[model samples]
Target: MAALNLTPSDTSTFMLMGIPGLEAAHIWISIPFSMFYMISLLGNFMVLFVVGKEQTLHQPMYLLICMLALTDIGTSTSIVPKALCIFWLNLKGITVCACLTQMFLLHTVTAMHSAILVTMAFDRYIAICNPLRYATVLTNVRIAKLGLVGLIRAILFVLPLPLLLTRLPFCANRIILHNPFCDHMAVLKLSCGDTTFDGIYGLVVSFIIIGSDLMLIALSYGLIIRAVLRISSKTAHQKPLNTCTAHICVILISYTPFLFTALTYRFGQGIAPHVHIILADLNFLVPPMLNPIIYGVKTKELRDKVGKYTSRR
Candidate 1:
């Protein structure tokens, strides 16, 4: 392995190896990857369409669903297309600028996705624990404001990542990224310069943003459960709990794989690179692909609206 001793420049490009040990199986692996991406696109678009076209679906919860759908689309779109190109077309060259841009979009949208889930948990909390104040608390204007704040927060935290990477010197010989997409850590690992600050900054950002969001979500659900348990009738318990079912499913799908991938990357020294890469890919693919399905199946109003629209079409 010859080291070219290169720095980040306008002309520097990185080669993406689709999967470290599965180059021979790249085309076969792409079959399911493409399917997941397509399902994510179609399902999330359906959610957006149903939410937008129906006046009855224009509540705070459904509006949040719209935001989730948009983020889901953004998340999948940011990584999957490039991945498919790497897998199928064997076109792996990515310029530094393009790689940084993709990294930014991927991280930003992912952060926003986490924020939206926290907001949804808050919605559930208000609707259950403080039913009387739900409407006033989560008005359309306020939701819009929340979305804006989430976007700004995501940008603030993730904007420095690519910028920080620009300062690190990348080795020309080490430009081939083993993963499908340009991840912050993967790119950082390629740097020959000191990465202590970059690594610490990334870990801090993840803990601050994702860690706090998870804690808030847990608190919201805890309160919701407490409120539900105090109900005297078993039948009444079903309704409020039912409303949270899809959200719980979405959260599980989104976070479980994410935590696994992150942990594997940091601590699983014995784990194979392909295993880590596959889990990381699934973390982005599974949640978006399943979110709309979960909501559609669990929420009666959304299901009815979707059914009606499809029947009419």
Candidate 2:
């Protein structure tokens, strides 16, 4: 299948017919997506209820998990319902304002989502590397502050992308986004204005949110591994090291596809729209659907806590 290469300005709307014979693919994708919606919402909502109800789980790590769960919920909320709506129902018309709103929140939430994961890594790192100071460092007040910082980072990172897009002159071709929701670079390309500034902004924000977060997560682990090696008790050290396993897995699951989509959308538009569409759709949907389940399945404490909590009711 050849890629559809329409910019946001050039094609106001994307018809399902553009992709040749694969219309059934959208239906197939919808089945998995609807299943994801149930699990993603239920799983994250359970985490919120558990952490909120249990004071024993009030530590920094659980606090961070709560935040991650919320992001998982929010990220899924930002993209999936709309995508499902378009895919299953064949509803494709989106106004310029509506599209930009989707793009803005999608970028902001995703950027913040990654930032919080990086912060969670740092929290785990500190808990492992410097046990005595963990309580002092990651106070409830501090966690709240970090939450604030994450929001600020999202706003700062994603604001420019849409702001640049708004300035562009929209030609009359605005129709439907081929995918369910807004694709930032995909939508941005449709602009009649010079998108150089938006492109530059997107790159800078990518490096800031994606690149910086990746480095921070790595550095935190480096310090963590060093501290883990110094512990004398096998049992004592094992528990701390085990706590980090979930964060590490979440980072891999969340970031790799994220960076892939961002890079591809920015750099790979010339390739084919079909390829870009897959990357873009997977980017928003997978993290939300998978992260909570992965954390629940992998982390014993979370599993036991959630299990006990569920059974009690």
Candidate 3:
């Protein structure tokens, strides 16, 4: 069915509601998001620096961590700054191309993240389950292959979603995006033509592309846990588990809300506009906050290393 663009009737649009109940809720939202933007920049840049500087961490695991941190940086930077600008400044107006570009980069990077998780899962699986094969499996050649695969897979799957979105016809009401960012479903809702194709294409991307990536990650962890159990020494088992723990936790937190948002849009409450808004914030804000804490704080090597690296005169 064709999605109706929001006319004057459907919009009590609290998109730029300023604040929830306070005097300047706009400033309130902008403040926290601004703080988050800074933290994301600092945390991820520290991660990149440590990984780059310390030759001891020149292994595949740290390399992947660097890449993951970079992805988090991209993910947060892609959406949050524009959102803060719209909220704090009076820059509420985004063009069709800008909106499409924002949505495209957001999803493209997100897709890369999911694929990276899949690759990291394999890395953990090999390091634990097939110790002898770990080096061969995740060699620089193979890592290069995985990186190329992730880049290509993300572009191949998610680029179409936004390209399809641009084909949508907008009526007179192309003004404010319901969410601060040019969210895919939110933008699709503005389409003057049938949104069925966009919705179907997005659903396929979600379930087949991202969902499949999650499943493979889970399977890798399954084999890993099995391998850990088969090991005789408890400490050895825990070592591998310890490394995988942060990644697994980040993956779960990052993904669950996104899938919930998708479900809420397609099958759950018909009020996608509000649910979408809340989930959009969570999807953007929560991960940037969570990634540093969950991933960085886990290992003493990273903690002490970053601590010393930053504390330098």
Which candidate leads the pack in lDDT? 1
For 1-313, candidate 2 gives per-residue lDDT tens digits of 1214443344444322222234678788778777877888898899888888878888777887888888778777877776766666655555566678878888888887887888898888877777799889889889888988999989977877777787787655554445567757667656667878777878788787888888888889888888878888877878888887777788888878876776786787686776766666677677777787888887777789899977988
Candidate 1: clashing residue pairs, number: 0
How many clashes in each structure?
0, 8, 3
Expressed as tens digits, the lDDT of each residue in 1-313 for candidate 1 is 1112333342578767779889899999999999999999999999999999999888889999999999999999999999998887777778788889999999999999999999999999999999999889999889988998999999999999999999988875545545799989878888889999999999999999999999999999999999999999999999999889999999999998888887787899999888888888888888999999999999999999999988998
Residue 74's lDDT in candidate 1: 96
Question: Candidate 3: deviation at residue 28, Å?
Answer: 0.9
Position 208, candidate 3: lDDT: 81
RMSD list, candidates in order: 3.2, 4.6, 5.1
Q: Which clashing pairs does model 2 show?
A: 8-190, 9-190, 12-173, 12-174, 12-175, 13-175, 13-176, 14-176
Give Cα distance to truth, residue 162, candidate 2, Å: 1.7
Which one wins on TM-score?
1
Pairwise TM-score winner, candidates 1 and 2: 1
TM-scores, all candidates, are 0.94, 0.87, 0.87
User: Cα lDDT of model 3 overall?
Assistant: 0.74
Error of 1 at 230 (Å): 1.7
| Local lDDT at 86 for model 2 | 61
By lDDT, is 1 or 2 better?
A: 1
